[model samples]
Target chain A: MAERAYIMPIALRLWHWTNALLMILLIISGASLHFTDPVIPLIRFDIARTIHNVSGIGVSVLYIFFAVWNSATGSWRQYIPELKGLKANLDRQNYYVFVGQLKGDAPHVVPTPEQKFNAMQQLTYIGVMYIAMPVVIVTGLAFFYPELAPAQLFGFDGLLPIAVLHYVAGFGLTMFLLGHLYMGTTGTTVAGGFRMMITGWHDEHDEKPENEQP
Target chain B: MAAIKTVIWAAIGLVLLTTSAIAQIERKPIAPEDLKNIQDSNAKCLECHSEGGFDTLNREGVDKDKLRDHLVDLGVYEGSNHGRVECKACHVKGFEEFPHAADDKKQINWCDECHTRKFLRIEMQFDESVHAKEGIKEKFTCSTCHDPHVFQAAKYMNSPRDVVRQDNDFCLSCHGSDQSFEQVSKEARPDLVENHEWLPNRPLHWNAVRCVECHTPVSKKVMSHEILPAEKAEKRCVACHSADSTLRLRLYKHMVSEERSRVGFVNSMILNEAYVIGATRNVYLDLALGIFAAVVVFIIVLHSILRIIAAWVRSRRNG
Candidate 1:
């Protein structure tokens, strides 16, 4: 038997794809700008600068809109994991991915409309969306309009710390994206998670594990 | 006897008047032929002036200091931008005599005579400089900072380090040396190193960045000549230490076009020429991040491969 639940909304799907596109553009353009070389130019310097600036602004604006919309619709709850038994739940999820999945065991937790993300996804999403995105956005804007950055920070130029922070946060997001994409394939089917995002419905089979982990 | 004395006095007054009138007249641009003729006439001037020898007729009043000031190194002058300029063009015609006329020293060659239109913007900038202040005007002139005999333009130089050294040398020639300062101002010289003690790595800053970077107001469109006083100099390290440093607008503005053409990392290009503390990139940091990302990708790929293999094995066993 299979059970279906409405997971992603139309608005959320639109925002997700738009944000993904912008992030990809920003990463490519930012890499071009950072490691610019005469012979191995991925993008023209002027063009890369333009793309980075435009995509940065686009993502920043989109994030603000998504934040307000999520708050208003009370959908923000999906990203907030229950603090009670959090460590145990996280441990169980980690066990399923690391050990149980290889032994052909079923997952202990499944997604629903009320709790759309698992414990790990909730924590990772909160960190990336709330912390890393804001840091990178603020730092990116500082680089774009440098005059706004504080003239000094702890005896160093303010931009130096800001540049370092932006690099770290951007790097974290890039790593997270790779992991997130790979994790998407670990659902009921290889393409099940991706199809769920597109169609706004999640389908999970109630099949018992052939070799259950005692 | 009284009539003869009066006549001698009148003739001297008439000669002074004629010399003053000649000094007041501004010379117009001359033809190439005339300029060559005037330059050729400088052979006699160079004979005494080159390599710093004494004036045989006026050796009694001449001291070592005065002789040293008057001496022009022939090689240096020939290499200067003003190498071909006629000596008489600056010093009025009557200087050929054994005892040079008194007014000849005061007969200033206003730089505008030949450099009229080309330097209009620079002339305007000079007008606003601290050196051009009312009381300071009499103490300084173009020659105070720029020794026409040995000056070479910064733009013509290939290396930016050489340009920075040359430009700072112009300021330090007066500010750093007491002997040079005494030639112009009566005020006691301030110690250059002591005044900049508050700055970290003072020598590096002095050599890498130009004195004008701090001493002059920033201007992106053109080089600023409004030299601020020591009290007014930029105190904020962020002014140059920041990624969007004011150095980009002033000192590095000239290199921007070439940097763009090469499409190298902006800070890397700056690092190639000069190492600014916070403005440049860290190779170690970049390498570490690159390795970290590569490891993350490897883990993701490995995990997915193992999971796929497990699923295939389970399906085969169930069937």
Candidate 2:
């Protein structure tokens, strides 16, 4: 039997699932708005615009809760690994993905109570949540109240540059989402990662103990 | 002897100069048949009216300001819709004589005289405009905004950006310049920027759209001339930010045909002029992003397949 650990708290799990739903809504609606067409419509322009605005505002509000909750609980540490530890973890991950995976070896790191994310996961989450999310939110607010944006940015209309920034950040987050889903499969079992997120119980060992050995 | 020599030379120079000047002034007399041709008549009028040599209005001792008012850029006039119309068609009254009658100065053409049928709606709207109010009506006229010599319809212009520049120029020519605004209005000229402090990105909005988009009433016509009071102007940003932006109906009405011709895309035409955030879309960006996402998904699926195959082989070897 495998050892178990409770890593995903109920509050964290709730926030995670809600954020996921909001992100999905925002991405779909954002795509619909970007490619608005009458003939083969993705979503009606009016509806998509409303959904995007609403979801964007919702995500922004939820992000405030995330920041405050993470800070209060000291869970933000999981997302900001020490440089020395991160370098070591990253080197191991690099080798595991490139060399070890081809040799049918298991991942070099696993989620534990002390560190919820591996080095690469921590870097990506920090970027998406702390940096890219803030940028997207600020730019979205500028769009909503365009009169507030600087009249000129680098000799271009302030909204022009802000719009580009918003699109790029959104694109980065979307690509992160694609990679995150794929990486979820590389755990003790193919479904183990997904089960942990849902059940909040990480199976500490592989289904077959032999697979845990090099 | 020296005085005699100087006088002789001066007298000869004066005679020669007078003869040369007279020769320069000489011109072929217009045949009676040529008088019937509008082009010949236009050429005759342009000889004195158009900007050029030392013989036009400058030679007539007209002040610089007055000369500027009368001189028409022949190129612009030729390119205009009224290009083919004979000068005499519009200048029907006192323009025949060289020093034309002063009384006929008031014989300036009124737009309604010729544009009665085609511009009936605009004329109606203009009559109801704030500019047409009792005291201001006498000072305001069609030529105040529309220069007959260079006027071109927004539809005929190359792009929406050009249309915005041209249309805004009409309003700014008066509202934007203190000299021009004071010429028509007795009221104190308000500072345009100061008045629009509440507006976000004032310069961008001013450049992207015409003043009339907010100042004028929304209408089914290509343009509305019934200018509302400042307080009555659209204050809500959603008027233009939403999917059914009023800009589509008012400022961008001319480009509606172009947009419709694009078949599937909505608000693509607006992208050519300005990005209205939610209202505007870029198909190229969407396509590229779509392709990127598709490739990412394909890679994920391929990786998942490989992982499944590896696990199956490992399990079989263990068994």
Candidate 3:
């Protein structure tokens, strides 16, 4: 029997979709700017620059809201990996993804309100949100306002270091997105994770706990 | 015997007439109409100004280096862009007589007479320059930097490397030496290389860009001729090295059309002319990025393929 639970909130769902769309826009526009003579004419260069800057600002605002909402709702804890069960959880998830899923075995963990992300997802999210995103944002702003960047930082003069850092961080975020997209389809159904994101409800094949049984 | 004597006298008279005509053609001052057709006026001027005619020592016994300076070398002047322009075109008031009058010698040639129409914008910039602002117009004429007799457009030079070398030389002619600056201006001269020690590869930077590019405020077409004070000069590399570099906006503004400015992040296509250290895109970096992205996608695709094959094999075994 499948038990349906309301895990994602309406506000969180809106933020997620908005953030996803903005990321796509930013990536496309950013790529257009970085590659002077891009093969695909996604958009005009000037338009791309304008859109990229606007989308970057939007992402920054959304990120701030996300931080505040996560803190307020205690959902921030979901991203912090539990050190005690981390090794076991990672091993089980890896085994299910690499081996057991191919043999049609059930995944080790089910989605819960308090524990949304798995151990691996939690660790990866932490790196992306805390390290990569911040690096990209800081360096992007540095590029935008070159006067603020130090003339010489760690032997690099001017905006050279900022540009390099921004590229590296953006590249990392792209890699993370690729992994995230692939993993989204690894749930019970091909579109199961996507459906949950849209509806704020997920169906699991686990029984209701005795304490919460009605 | 009488017929022979008459023939000899006539021959002598004819020879004298031919010699006088040749002297008239060679020594005659170029008329306003004739000036337009003359190929080499500097050579005509050098006919009298060269070697024996003009003395280095003047009537007052002062070594008038300034007066002797007007003397042109036919060899050098012949090779210049200005070689074709008649001397009367620039030295308008002078040279109606054998010795030019005092007022004629003192007459200032206005560059604006011709330059105003072709380079009106640059002329306007020059009018607003610090030299003009300070009323040092007499001391800082066009001839100060550009020797009118031997000047050529830097772009038309043999190579880009020569262009850079010549452009820097134009500035260094005055600023490079303390004595030159002292002779020209009342201001104390600063050591050019020492003042620019903050910039890495100072000589390389000097070679790559014009001194006015950084020292003057940005303009529409030409770089502003108004040299800023040392403290006011642009120190940040990003001012010219960034996507919205002022160098492009001012120096290469024509290259950035309305259509192109609207199309890309960088306003101008001329950015591809040279590798702009950090501002311009790198092909090697792009290739690396492409390889990295492909590897990431390949890993995910390979893993998915393995999972699919494994699932199919298991299902077949079960069946």
Flag regions of model 2 displaced more than 4 Å.
A85-88, A98-104, A152-156, A205-214, B1-273, B278-295
What are the lDDT scores of the predictions, listed in order? 0.72, 0.73, 0.67
Considering summed lDDT, which 10 consecutive residues are worst modelled in model 1 chain A? A205-214
For B1-319, candidate 3 gives per-residue lDDT tens digits of 9999999988776345322210111222456665456655555566556554465333443344655766776555655666656677778766745467568856656677778764576656677766666566678767777787767564334333445566567778878888887777788777776788877546556755677777789766555667776777887665665555665654344344421321122432333233343245545566788899999899889989987887789779999
Q: What range of 10 consecutive residues in model 2 chain B has the weakest lDDT sum?
A: B18-27
Residue by residue across B1-319, what tens digits does model 1's lDDT show? 9999999988776345322211111234568897578567776677667664444424555454655567777677755666667677787655767567768777656777677774687767777777776356677667777788888665445556676888898998888888988877777888887888877657667766789989888887777777877888887665665456677787666555545311122344354455454456566777789999999988888887898788889889999
Query: lDDT by residue for model 3 over A1-214, one digit each (tens)?
Result: 7778899899889988998888888888877666544334456555776788888888888888977887888878888877876787788778878888877776667777767777788889999988988888877776566555564332223455577678778888888888988998888777998999999998864634221101
The order of the candidates by lDDT, greatest first, is: 2, 1, 3
In model 2, the Cα lDDT at residue B314 comes to 80
The order by descending DockQ is 2, 1, 3
User: Per candidate, chain B TM-score?
Assistant: 0.66, 0.70, 0.63
DockQ scores of the candidates: 0.10, 0.10, 0.08
Instruction: Considering the two chains of model 2, state its CAPRI-style docking category.
Output: incorrect
For candidate 1, please provide the TM-score of chain A on its own: 0.91
Q: What residue pairs are clashing in model 1? A: none
- Which of 2 and 3 is ahead in DockQ? 2
RMSD of each: 22.1, 16.8, 21.1
What value of lDDT does candidate 1 attain over all alpha carbons?
A: 0.72
Query: Tens-digit lDDT track for model 1 on A69-172?
Result: 87998978878888887898788889988988788776666776666777888899999999999999998887765545564443223456678789889989
Model 1 Cα shift for residue B211 (angstroms): 18
